[model samples]
Target: MKRDLGRGGIVVHPYRGYGSRQEVFVMGRVFRQAALGRAIPHHGVLRDVADVVRRIARHGVAGVRVEASLGANRTTATTDRDGFFDIHLPLQTPLPQGLSWHQAELQVSQGDDRMHCHAEVYIPPPETDLLVISDIDDTVMYTGVADRLRMLYRLFVQKAHQRTAFPGVAALYRALHVGADGEARRPILYVSRGPWSIYEMLEAFFQLNCIPVGPILFLREWGLSWRRPWPRRAEDHKHDLITRMLTMMEDLPCVLIGDSGQHDPEVYTRIVKEHPGRVKAIYIRRVDRRPDRERAIERLREEIAHSDCELVLAADSAAMAAHAHAKGLIAQHDLVEVHQACVDEG
Candidate 1:
């Protein structure tokens, strides 16, 4: 299929390498106007089915009641209930090959109006089977500016409007979650000491940073000596969350990325020992000065020494890439090499 995108241009979605009888699906939502000013409710938007029509223009046919792009030779079904469209073309169907490219366009005709959106779909590259579990606070994000006072302020008094993923974080995570070929996998779970009250703020930060979304588990404020909602202690709260996530991904090999600023090393070491095959590698980012942090990391490493996972300290994304490459987790050219790749993408 070919589409006249614009002046002196065309587009196409080639059907190659896809197995016969397989469903070709393109999924997303469409919204409609409601009142005069307010945005349409996300959940209330109705789904509209789009028909895919393919045609080939010949000298004999002039305007023979054409239905859609190409020339109206075939018809596909409407989108799903979620406003998603699926085009299923069988292997028996003969494809056009003379053009420089194949074009696929979305055709939606409702009431008396007609809309056409064209796209060129190409097969994506392969992705690696690697999981990247990261810590919050000073590790994946920045919260070290004000120390405990700042932390307390952000938790209790003020909202976390300033939270952001560190440099290269978004790019690195996006690459891990979605492969270079554009196939997105289950993102690495976030185990943080952050409270759940700022869920909206944290969610917004993820969006602003273009970080891949993941299930976030937070800790309570039990350690503050006040506002203790849960009976379990603070350390126990974090430890339990980490254990559960580690267990959840037990079948998949994962990398533990965190900083030496907190109890990540300790918690990760325990998880490695408990679930020997789960952890593939551990990368600890260097943080602010803490003389005792080294001893703590050493002890944690000693505890997990029996595990097959290797632990290293990375000063930047390059170092992390080195570790990932050595372990055959990701390609050396992956986004991990870009320092602060997340911010770089922006």
Candidate 2:
């Protein structure tokens, strides 16, 4: 029950994980907390550098043994060099009907004490019409991810509640979670290219902004951890993760959301091609205003033409929400909430 192994100087950062019909993945990091919190750097030059140093310093014990059990299934995983452990277990029977997620126990042995905690693993019900997987950077909040200085400033200075979700994203995401009939209660997975160091902060951000939380999946551990795949870090990350979901939940369709500032267009295009009719929609927020970027996304429409997926390049959340409303992907009444949420700065 003690997730933060304070006495043992170890903390397990287990995310609200997700799964399909019979398979559930529960992932978390068991890192060593720094003896004391690092000071916020004063100069701009030190801000970004200091943050990375702090993250790796706090990134705890690697190769630790982990024990996780889901229902009758139990599995063990060793933390990688980055102190991250991802365990996959399969359930023989489907979770109870009408349930969106299930809680499973995970135990980590550190020295004399065996610390443990329960982490939520989402299991989409049979009624789910679509599964939503969204990115968190420029897509969810204004982190200024492309700008290194601004991104470091936001990451170090801003608290989760202080962070803001892109206009109308909360309402738009909520509508998708509830589905078109206003009661389907689908699953929404939040993923990012960033490391697991910000997991707690991201969780608080989701809770504060009212975005439905399913699983927080990340592709790599970022700069400090050179172990991440080189060159293609963002590439095929969304495609690969979604493929796993699609493989497990064969009957359900999927909707992808990300910003044009990154490789979302290309990654999503690959998913649409590889999965065929499983993708319902792809919403890429147009954060990049360059003429070349606009034309680039336009070409993706041609790529996914034959598939049921429609890649919509929109400038704002309102545009995507409008499209979803017109298509009855989200309840019509939810449009007002979407419009209102977009303008709500708080």
Candidate 3:
């Protein structure tokens, strides 16, 4: 899908890479300004329409060179027609997993297209006790992702700094990262159905609100084009991604977090059933007000009865924190901090 060479200029779109002490994996895309979009003034519904139009006009540049560098080690690959590239490099000297986040540079080059950018490659510490995998939309923030029009309004209308997170989410995540004894940097990974286009905005949202920094994995590129559905559905993508994360670290068990506004309950329930004893707990924020939705969650509770996994449909972060504390997922002091954070938000 070779796109036209544009005066819009080429930009490097490197996602936050992930790896361990042995090697590092890097992934990114190179596209015109129209693809990732320029920081232009946009307002309301019309702005949403403009975003879609830009994506439809975007294709990709083939055979662009990409170089990924970490410390003295460097690796290279070329972008496909979709302008995407991924490279796995074995290190002569492996990085210590004690380092929470490792900095890596990605340099993109073609005939006239040349750009250099930085990507944060994440490596979970060796002492990580419990892994936390969470969703971004309604689970962390106030976005109505299950509702498309409302999701559009919040996404396109608000700036990154202006977007609001659910109360006490940052504190809850931090507590999970710094385990029960408060000495561990338990790995916390954030997953989203959203495209790679909003990576900067999402990163800003996390940092601005004091959430724990970890590898943020997005399932695909932007879904703006009306071409086809997506590479895969949301439920399928999330389940597979989480499964890979769990398989990556065999010793550490995970606690999954999401909202009731979407298919989180269904996806997570299946995961818990498939891999018994792998998931510690499932915390889902009760977003939908409908009784049928509530009953749907209750049915999920019955479905997971054969397993020891606890499915909690909580009303707020405070309640969820209390539940996690009682379940020994977090410490008592951590619960207190989460409650205090909620009070501060008010």
**How far is 90's C-alpha from truth in model 3 (Å)?**
4.0
lDDT tens digits, residues 1-346, model 2?
2443223367777777778766888888887764333454454655645544555467557878889887777889999887878888877855677677678888888778687888888887777788888888889887877887777667655668778788888889989889788888888877787666777678889888888877888886664536742224456667788788788778688889999998988988888898788888999998899999899899988988877789999878888998888878987789778877767743
lDDT of each: 0.51, 0.78, 0.79
Worst 10 residues of 1 by lDDT: 48-57
Q: Which residue pairs in candidate 3 collide?
A: none
* lDDT tens per residue, model 3, 215-260: 7887666545456643345558888888877776776788999999
TM-score of each: 0.55, 0.88, 0.85
Better of 1 and 2 by lDDT: 2
Overall local distance difference test of candidate 2: 0.78
Considering every candidate listed, which one attains the maximal lDDT?
3
Which candidate comes out best when scored by TM-score? 2
Put down candidate 1 lDDT per residue, 196-222, tens digits, no spaces: 334446666777777766545465523
- Quick one: how many clashes does candidate 1 have? 11
Which has the higher TM-score value, candidate number 1 or candidate number 3?
Answer: 3
